[model samples]
Target: MLLLLGLGAWAEKAPAETSRPALTVSVQQVNFVDMERTLSATGNIRPWQDASVSVQTSGLRLKEVFADVGDIVQAGQLLAKFDDTIIRAEIEQTRAAIIQAQASLEQATQNAKRIRRIMGSGAVSQQEADQVLATEKINQAQLSSAQAALVGQEQRLAYTRLLAPYDGVVSAKSAVLGAVYNPGQELFHLIVQNKLQWEASVSSRHLSALEPGTKVLMHVREDLFAEGTVRQQSPALNEQTRQAIVYVDIVPGAQVKAGMFVQGDFKLGTRKVIAVPRQALVLRDGFYYVFVLENNNRVALRKIEIGQSLPNGVEVLAGLVSGEIIVVKGARFLEDGDMVRVALAASETAAGAGSVMSFARAGR
Candidate 1:
């Protein structure tokens, strides 16, 4: 009877020993960080300067177009050509008239010189000599008029070829082949120098944060961030929207174009943050919890309010303090009031500590 009682007590003790099995977990102390706060906004991307190229002379047919929309060109590069048939013919006629005027002036000059020589010898009358001089002056005036006309026609001929005013991409083209165009008509639209900027509309309340050289991030493609800077801010609030415009000069070569709508944000300033490794977080019943390692290796599930999500951890806005130890790994397998054996082996502890330190450095 004594042996049976002893066996029964041993069985009861065996079951009790297995009931509170200790779980091995790795933990780290909460770290404090200073994180920059940002203000969100949406805006349109536009070129820094826009220009409208127009035809200078009237009544010309567009014969050829060397560039189209989206073509990159340089200053003085030909974009379109006008038919120079009529202008060429006019130029040729003016040149012929110049030749005729030159011949007439030369002949009249010779006649005046000969008449003056003979008038001193009494071989030519005074009245006749005066008439020769007058003829010479008339021919000179005619030659001057003809030369001026030639110069004007030559300038008009050069105007037949439309050229780019600056280095830019063709945003729009209105010139059609073989179509007649009038004076001062828009032939093409260009974004001057192909430079682009973001015009973000921010609320007037946050205007103080916006200043020249303030950092900005423009979201061009999904998951793509383009860095920029605030170049200027509007002087007053827009009467309609009660917002001010902030112009951000984007870094060149970003995959962005003018007239594209993009979302962006301005980094206002930084504030203190307390953070823990992401592995330490647990979600149950719409609440975030962390396994805090309490005295005697006991784990306590403490509710937490998480703020910004980081690359390697979550920011702890409330319910946690810096320098507190929390489970960094294997926290999901733990429960409140459970006993845990902290992984204290040299290599294991080093691994955990390294992870936490790396997370802190990255968050900065």
Candidate 2:
């Protein structure tokens, strides 16, 4: 009977002594840290100014194309050329007409002077003198008309050579060799100054915070980013969407092109928030959870609401408070109300005398 009672007592104590912790985990306290706040928006890349280059003269055959699509050109650079053979011939004819008119006017003036001198002497009749004066006036008017016509012809000749109106990149080209183009027909389309802008649609409520000169960061690709500045905002909001257009001028780069849709963020300064290390959180069933350390080395798995992502970790919007001890490492292997062994840091081991009291309480 004594042996039986001793064995029973040993059996009752063996289970507690042999039981082991579920896992060893590192713990940390949640704390507040300053984090940058931003408002996100999506928009398209577009040229700052789109200009069309067209011919101003009619019936001119395209002689040569100097610039094609994607060519960078400076102001007044020749883009294309017309035959100019007909224009040059017309110009020469006009010059000849001007010369003829000048000669006729000189002769008429000399005759008119001679007639005026003889008018009082009766060597020339009054009617003949009047006719000479009138003839001189007619020749003078003819010379003026010819000079104006010569100017018109020279202008036409200049029009045969098409030039860029400003510094830009050629986006389109329609000028073809040997094709006759008429006046006001577009031959090329240019992106003025090769500049680009982002046209972002932002909510009306957020419009008040955006202004000219505000900084912006745009994501061009997975690993690429471009910086931009806010240029202006639409004066009115869209009636149907209640969103306003914000124009942001981007720094010129080869990666960006007009009409490419991209995502971007507007920097609105910073704010303070409670955050934890990224590894401390566990994801399950579309919800995030953290293992909060409870009394007696036990952990409670609690659901948390997350907000903005930070460089150090993620913002915990709810379900956790400051000064709460939470599992940082080995949290995924833990379940609710599981007993754990807290890995003591080097400092805690150094002050083992002070931790003895806490460890004794945890053993219970």
Candidate 3:
């Protein structure tokens, strides 16, 4: 009789021991919050305005280069100089020719006056007077030609010095000292105002949502971001890729550079969403899950569809609802049907203490 009684007692205690809690965790109710809707895209960084600086005169040797790659320059600043020795000699020669032509023209005018005065005076015939007048006219033409030559040489002298067209940063330099360059040969490349833009390629379906003045967040590096605004959108889409280019003007900063490939987000608008702390999520077999607290302190594993990621949490798109209790901490070690000990969070504990004090004061 004693052995049978002891066996029954052991069996009853075994079931109670087996039902112990698997872990201790904190729980909270899911709530709705305002989140911004965004469209993600990837593309390369480019200059807002790429200006090419080229030489206008041919057969001129590059004498000096004052600007180089990565140098900031202002408008009308001299960037380079060409050998003007030959050009200067030509200019002096043209001026001398003009002076000689003027002297000859003065002599011709005096002779023409003398011939007209002598006409019908028995000193010169009418035909001889006409020939003298024609000679004076030829001298006048020669003087005009010499003056035009002088202007042309002076214009060539101005082209010897290369000046910046606008304020910008030099990005490339191909000009070499003592090297002869031809007209239209590009010598320098400038980025106007040192400005940059992110040329992002986005799908055509999302083009309507974008417009000028829309906000953008560019990811320049890890833990770093640059603000941007939509300057314009391409009027047409790529026929092969079906994607359109969105030109985003980034705020001037050192964090971004031209030709860099980066990712960014376009803020379309805002919407209300249900979210939970990041700690409450668990990944299993390529799916995300959360532990939903049920009756009897047991947790049921629930799968969830996630949306945009927030700073401290993630948006729950589906499989969850507001006011549902879920494990906020210590959820990684939990499994389905496991019983857990629900510990009061710090905020809850503080609230409970405040209530106790209030009740004590009321009783007194």
Candidate 4:
């Protein structure tokens, strides 16, 4: 009978140890704070101005190509050259015609002068003097025509040597050596002025908050960031998407390139909020919950509403108070209505003892 009593006592003692708290957890008090509210959007980098470089004068073989795709050029810089042999020969021919016309005019002028002197003395006939004057006028007209032709040929010769119209980076090229091309053919495409901007579109509802000079932060990559400002906003919105575009001017000298897709945020305003560590929140059945410490060292699982996710923590929109203590660590192994041992640091323990001792003296 004594042995039976001992076994029963041991059984009751085992249940007591099993009923102790499952684990110790750290907790933090909720904080009330203010944070910036931002609007995010996606966009692409594009050149502020772009141009299609084409051949103005053609019908000749491409003799040499000096600039290719990805080449940077300045205004009036040589980009390519055509076979100038044909145009150069035409220019020389025009020059010779001008010289011949000049000689003819000079001879005709001398003849008219001689005729004028003889006509008064009856040595030249009236008809002959009139003819000499008319010849002189004809030769003068011929000289003018020849000069105009020479100017046109000279202009065409200049066109044979292709030059860049503005400072830009070559984005495309079609020029091939020893290949004949016609007028208006695109030989190279340039990104004019080498300037880039982000073309981003946002919902029409958020348009009023964004304006010129608003601060923007562009996410170029995981670790890289670029700062920018809103240059302008489109006055109209798309009928289908109901979105408006905004041009953002990013700072130069970044690793960003044209045609790269990027995402960014626009700082609009600020708002007051209450938040807690992200680890303190638990998600189950698509609902978020936090372990709130109650009286008697017990924990109660409380369902909470979550708002925007911040950089360090999450904003709690409802179901929590500013001064409430919630579990910070070791919450994954906990459940509702579980008795817990509040684990306090050395300093916290000292502070708690001091507060209690002061309260006891007041009660006395």
Clashes of each: 0, 0, 0, 0
lDDT of 1 by residue, 1-364 (tens): 9999999999989866755535766778887887778888999999989888889887888999999999988999999999999999998998999999999999999998888777778787888889999999999999999999999988999899999999998999988898988889998999888888999999988888788999999888887888899999978888999998899999988888888899998888888799887878999999999988887778899999998876667788899988788887678877788776665546656666532321111110
Using lDDT as the measure, name the better of candidate 1 and candidate 3. Answer: 3
Residue pairs in collision within model 1? none
What TM-score does candidate 2 get on C-alpha atoms? 0.82
Instruction: List the candidate numbers ranked by lDDT, top first.
Output: 3, 2, 1, 4
| C-alpha TM-scores of all predictions | 0.69, 0.82, 0.82, 0.78
Q: Name the candidate that leads on lDDT.
A: 3
lDDT of 2 by residue, 1-364 (tens): 9999999999999888746677766788878889888889999999999989999998888999999899999999999999989878888888898899999999999999889878889788889989999999999999999899888888888999889999999999998899987789999999999999999999999998998998999999999898999999989999999999999999877478898999999998888889988988899999999988888888999999999999889998999898788888778877788888876656766876322111212332
Model 4: number of backbone collisions: 0
| Cα error of candidate 3 at position 109, Å | 4.5
- Of the two candidates 1 and 3, the one with more favorable TM-score, higher being better, is 3
Residue pairs whose backbone atoms clash in candidate 2:
none
Deviation from native of the Cα of residue 149 in model 2, angstroms: 0.8
> Could you tell me how far off, in angstroms, the CA of residue 82 lies in candidate 2 after the best superposition?
0.8
**Model 1 quality (TM-score):** 0.69
Off by over 4 Å in 3: 1-23, 107-130, 295-298, 330-340, 345-348, 351-364
Clashes (candidate 3): 0
Off by over 4 Å in 4: 1-23, 34-36, 106-137, 221-226, 267-272, 295-300, 332-339, 346-364
